[model samples]
Target chain A: MLTKRIIPCLDIDKGRVVKGVNFINIKDAGDPTELAEFYNSEVADELVFLDITATHEGRKTLIDVVKKVSSVVFIPLTVGGGIRTINDMRIMLEAGADKVSLNSSAIKNSAIITDCSKEFGAQCVVSAIDVKKEGDDWIVYTHGGRNKTNINALEWVKNVEELGAGEILLTSMDKDGSNNGYDNELLEKVNNIVNIPVIASGGAGSLKHLYEALKFGKADAILAASICHFGILSIKEVKNYLIKNKINIRL
Target chain B: MPDISILNTKSANFHSVKKAIDLYNKQNIITSDINEINNSKGLIIPGVSSTDTVMQNIKDLNLEKIILDFYSSGKPILCICVGMQILFENSEEGVKPGLGIIEGSVKKIPKLKNKFKVPHMGWNQLELVKESEIFKGISTNTNFYFVHSYFCDPLDEEIIIGKTNYSIQMCAAIQKNNLLAVQFHPEKSGKDGLKIYENFNKMIS
Candidate 1:
């Protein structure tokens, strides 16, 4: 059976982990490698390192962070932020990233999806779409949910799949940082459109929310950030909850 | 430790494979040179591209003969994903001929009614059918990471040692005498994945 994944996402800034990671066990909660190792030890199915620092120098350091984390963590590693070209994707992949997530750059130039997928198989490309609800229709937002695109969320999901994206990282801007639950309605709608795996992100306040995302939303994976980072939920706890709920999970 | 040559067809993440094996303290190299591969105790054809591209790359690197030679020489050979698919006669995804070491044809996984995805990405369990050195320390039904759109269909089912299900029972791992291959990437499979490399090293020395 193919198990659903519980991924711990780390927001990296200037090559260091940020975004309210307050783990008492980790001496340096700011370190990317240590946080990655902690998550790996807790049995995180995968890890995503998003470079919040969009500066040129930050890009160079993110590569270093990816190399260090991949050296220690054996699971799949995905790096995003400031990935503008196929060459940028190559640099991260060469640094040992398994997949490169495309967010702002992907929306700025949708052709990068086709080009990256062609150069490095479709499985290596992850399209991250941030969306906001607007009168029953979801709007695609870029620049970390700051700028809105004219693309409809469902239409964009279908177009992304046709453009050769292997996976979709769908985030609900309203649900994100809200501590409510994943937007299962949006997730289910996107899941219905794309045959490829959809990773449900934003608004995972508890284990039940994760369950609902997989059960009601049918998302292939759940991207847990605040819950795991704040120690409210661990990756193992999420997997355990899913297993108890009759979900096929890697425990 | 004997040298392990990860044959670089100029495709796939052999570096990740090299990293995994390095944890086992194995001497390995990622190279396309025929001599380096022939001299190594084991050869790993790590693949992550279309069959046509990998096959063409093998020919370009002049590794087609080298790979066939190593297979018959009784040296351990590990083929990954597309690497495993290319061992068959041919594939539906690509037109180029495979190495034909294993009598099989690669076919695309059918799209089920919203139940299963095409790439079959993410973690999936392994159903061991027969004992093989590659899975010496691995458990049955243990999840391993996989990302591929097609599956292998061997003419002789007896060669299949590992099986997995997405929508159908597809061959996940295979072994024939001294040759071994897996549809999943052990290097990307965490602890159990590293164990696969450790077991592969055991096959070497």
Candidate 2:
């Protein structure tokens, strides 16, 4: 049976993890390497390191962090943010990331996803879409939910899959900091359309939220930050809760 | 520059496997290529990860016949980690069939009641269960690094040369005909690990 993964998302900037209340007002969490080792000890099913630094030097710093984290953590790690070229994907993977998540770069040049997937493999490419509700429809947002694209969220997801993305890491820009719950409506919309694994991200406050995401939303995986980074929910505790809820977990 | 000689359909990082070979050769260990085993030189196929997938990969590359040819020639073939598991009949992890060089299927260590991790993930000692050229320098309880979730259950019990207790009488090493395999990482297993590779080197030499 395929295990429902429990992932912890780390927003990295300049080799340090910075967690924000709602993607703003960042607070230094710790060294990226240390956080990675901690998560490995906690038996996180997977880890995602998003390099939020938009500068060239920041990109170099992110690669350094990836190399450092890979040496310590044995579990799978995925790195993203500011990745523009296939060489970037190759370098991050060679640096120890099991997968590479592409957001803005993918939106800019969707062919990169297919090209990278062909060169590497589908299992190694992740397409992250930031979605925010626009009236009766969900619109795809880029630049970390600041600019809404003309494309619908569901349509973008389908496009990504057609482009050979192995998985979709869907983030709800609306419920992000509210912790009200996952955008189940949006998740279902994308889930019904894409055959690849769907990882729900943003707006998970408690275990019940994760349950709702997997149960009602039918997400293959859950990606949370505030809940995990702030000790509101540990990966083990969440997995245990999910198991009690009859969801498939590695534990 | 493609550094990997074999494009594994599963794990394509042939560079790392080549690195392991280069590191072994630096220690004065002679490693034989897969194409040369028929002429009497032994061949080493060390697998650090992905037993089931690697087996599928070999079949995908259409190289199983060549491997069976090596086995038929009575040349020594060493399997390391998951590589050892592929020497068996099947594995529970994937639907792909193994080489059937040995008689058993690989299955996960039954869910243990205690906290000994599934992949084992670290170095542990190998206690000899029988005599073979592979265990020449390795002593009783000699530590060798291991990282795997599945084990081989050779149909012929006599071929089980050594056992390492993780959950069951796990086959640490198996020897039959000219085939030898170990469930530990020799490249990362320190001096003793190097000797295990050296023993293989001697066999092939």
Per-prediction DockQ scores?
A: 0.83, 0.08
**When only chain A is evaluated, what TM-score does every model earn?**
0.98, 0.94
- What DockQ class does candidate 2 belong to? incorrect
The lDDT per prediction is 0.90, 0.72
Docking class of 1: high
Runs in model 1 with CA error above 4 Å? none
Model 1 TM-score?
0.98
Candidate 1: residue pairs that collide? none
State the local distance difference test value for candidate 1: 0.90
Tens-place lDDT per residue, model 1, B1-205, is: 3389988888788878888888876578888876778889988889997889899888887888898899999999999999999999989998899999999899899888767888999899999999987898888999899999999999999999999998999999999889999999999999999998899888888
The per-residue C-alpha lDDT of model 1 at residue B10 equals 89
Question: Candidate 1's residue-wise lDDT over A140-213, tens digit each?
Answer: 99998889889899999999999989999999999999989999999998898889999999998888899999
TM-score of each: 0.98, 0.64
Model 2, span A213-234: residue lDDT tens? 9899988788868898877767
